[model samples]
Target: MMSEWLVYPALGVIAGIFAGLLGVGGGVVIVPILLFVFTTQGFPAHHMMQMALATSLGSIVFTSIASFMTHHRHGAVRWDIVMGISPGILIGSFSGTWLAAQLSTRALKIFFACFLYYVASTMLRNFKPKPSRQLPGPLGMNGVGVVIGVISSLVGIGGGSLSVPFMMLCNVPVHHAIGTSAAIGFPIAVAGTLGYVVNGLSIADLPTPHLGYLYIPALFGIALFSFFSAPFGAKLSHKTPVVTLKRIFAVFLMIIATRILWGAL
Candidate 1:
């Protein structure tokens, strides 16, 4: 239990830094590690994946806020873009959680692993859509938001992996896209977390000390450290070279994806 305590908090620190650095909401890191931890603790296999996803999204609620504020302080976030896409994000995110609840645990894990592979591949290739035009109008942005929200919620992420790239495609500067994605993460996390809470409510055999799918102790531990570390990460993002950070993150994601794929199979 003591080791669990230490490990969960340490995950938070890493998640926070990643969220600030990449605007990924930290769930890319959080979900896999939580799956391993919960499985090792002899948690029920049937519920473990959902629990991990729920807890990861729950932690992101706070982490996103911390990261967003830090980025905002540096004037990187684009408020207009955030406003344009948020409504669709909320709707799509909530719907995605409902969809996830209907899937088998193994199915969800496989899906998540595949999605991670896609993200890692994109990053590794440094694929950037050529800027062919200006940012999309409101309806187009909202449509894109829906895609980002649904994919993110299904995979227990903050939508940054998709949103950042989409923003870049729209000719938004990379740094501003990252900062805006941090802002976007808050809404994705909030809607997705609430959806998980609601969907998991009817499970009669949930493990102890949980709020719906969320494991309370792990949530607290992860959120606490992530909150403090996020600001530092945000500071570092301003100083670090973006390409270097993306390459490092891409490698990390590939490793995580491979591990998850093995587990799911």
Candidate 2:
């Protein structure tokens, strides 16, 4: 328990470092870390994944704020995209949490592992879809948001993996895509957090210092550092040479995903 104080903040630092730079790392890092810690600490096997997902989202609520605000200052965020997609994001994120709460832990782990693998491969290849058209109409944006929001809730991600690609496909620039994805993460986290909290309220014997699926101690630890560090990452995104670093991160995600898949299966 005491050691958790030291290590949980480390998770925050990692999350904050990547949140703005990649627009997606908060959940990618935090969910698996929390899942492992909770499993070792004798948290309910059946509920641990949901707890991890919820807590990660809660942390992202803060991290994404710092990240997107920084990106906005750099003139990288796409406000039109954020506004057009938010309605659907809210609906899909909330509903997806209900679906996640109903899923078995094994099912969730398998899905999340696969998603990680996909993200890794995409990052490794530096894949960006060729622009086919301009930004979509409101209805189209809403529909796209639904898919991204649903997947983000289920996988406990910031939706950058999905949204960034989609944005690039629609001719949005890379920095803008990443920044808009950060902005998009906020609503997804908010709706997903609420859904997980509401869904988990009736469950018994959860760990203390919890709000529904959120483990407050971990949330506090993560948020504290992530808030301060996220701006740094956002700044770096505007200036850093990240090709080599991105490859390294991609390989890291690959390793983590493979390990998770092994455990899940």
Candidate 3:
């Protein structure tokens, strides 16, 4: 058996690459992987899924930082848009955690897997939205941000799937949209992580040394490698043909999602 020491860092490297390259939160994949790892570690089945969600978001806090900084250095992120939407993101993310806490573990797993399928299919399509208009006003962007934040918190993603499409629809180029999505993920991760932490604090029988629902060791292990690896992916985003890789990764998500769905049933 591979030790968690090895496994978690490996996961971080893989997730960080996906985060930087695709402008995704990497938690799209990280959540399910964490669930599997947590299961192996004998965590309470009752809280396993949410803990996975929380831990995934926690790791993304580190992943998004490095990823966005690299993207920012490349002049790909749109700071104006990130600033405009952040208020709404924080409000929505903070509330979404409470909503997540109310769901049963099985229900949450099913819902999470369904969302994963949606993310995978979107990637496989590689659909670029046709730009129909300029970016919305601050009020409109904030309204959209609320929706993105709520959904992101519920699903433990960094909001890339939603934000990237929204940016493209606003006439941003694909690269710019990806980078901007990475930036946007920062607020989502911060709020989502806090939400999960606060929501999980009252629960009992959890693994110790946790911050709310986050598994501390998993968080640290993933964060350490992701910090170094995200910059590499960010650089690759500018130089590589990420399309093929995204499709391959989408298929991987599909398989893992199916596994989750089966367990939920």
Candidate 4:
């Protein structure tokens, strides 16, 4: 138990660096680790997935703040896009959190596993935006934002996977889209974490050191390590070959998703 508590901070550091470098939600790394760690700690199997998902969202709140600030400082964020998508993200996050709470742990794990495979496949396809001559109007932007919000909220992602592609299709530069996506993560994390916490309030048998849906030790540890590590990851992103990184990340996701799916069955 004592050692498990110490591992949370280390998990945060690793997840934060990945989030910064890949612009992912951090759940990809956090969820698996939490599932393994919590299970080893003798938490009930029925509650393990729920706790993992909830704790992942809670930890994202901190990493998102750090990543968003870093991107904003670089002047890459598009405030207009962030504003346009916030309302939809807030609503979707709440709904998704509620939905997740209603599902069985096995079901949730299965869903997550499948979703991860989809993300990996999409990345491997090297999907690129079709050339567009015109910029998207307000209505078009709002529609895209809504879709991104709903999907991201449900999957515990930061919306980059969807938003970046949509922005590229709409004529936004890749760098700007990535930066804006990072900024958008802040609102998504905030709303999603709050929703998970509120929805989990009725779960009477959560493990020790937990508040609502969140594990305090995990949150504190992840926050402490990820905050500083995120900046470092962001720095590395600029130097690394993006194409190579993408392939590596895709492969990593594929392996994890396969393992998770097999475990669920």
Query: Among these predicted structures, which one has the highest TM-score?
Result: 2
lDDT of 2 by residue, 126-228 (tens): 8889999988899998998898889999998778888988999899998899889889999999999999999999988899889898889899899888888
Worst 10 residues of 1 by lDDT: 18-27
Candidate 1, which segments miss by more than 4 Å at Cα? 21-24, 235-249
Estimate TM-scores for all models. 0.91, 0.94, 0.93, 0.90
Q: Residue 97 in model 1: shift from native, Å?
A: 0.5
Model 1, 1-265: lDDT tens digits are: 7887899999999988877675555888899889988988998888888899889889889878877887799999999999999998998899988988898889999999888888777877878777667888888888888888888888888888889888887899988998899899999999999999999999888877898888888999999999998778878988989677888888888888888788778
Model 4 ranges off by over 4 Å: 131-143
Task: Indicate the residue-level lDDT of 221 in model 4.
Answer: 84
- Name the candidate, 2 or 3, with the larger lDDT value: 2
Q: How far in Å is the alpha carbon of 93 misplaced in model 3?
A: 0.9
Collision count for each candidate, in order:
0, 0, 0, 0
lDDT score, candidate 3:
0.86
CA lDDT scores, all candidates in order: 0.87, 0.88, 0.86, 0.77
Scored against the true structure, residue 112 in model 3 reaches a CA lDDT of 87
lDDT score of residue 23 within candidate 3: 58
Number of residue pairs clashing in candidate 1, backbone atoms closer than 3 angstroms, sequence gap of 3 or more or interchain: 0
* Model 3 Cα lDDT, one tens digit per residue, 1-265: 3497898899989888877676566788688888888888899998898898888888888778877887899999989999999999998888888888898789988988899899889889987789998899989999999999889988888898899889999999988998898889889999999999999999988997788888888898888888888778878988887888889888988998899899889
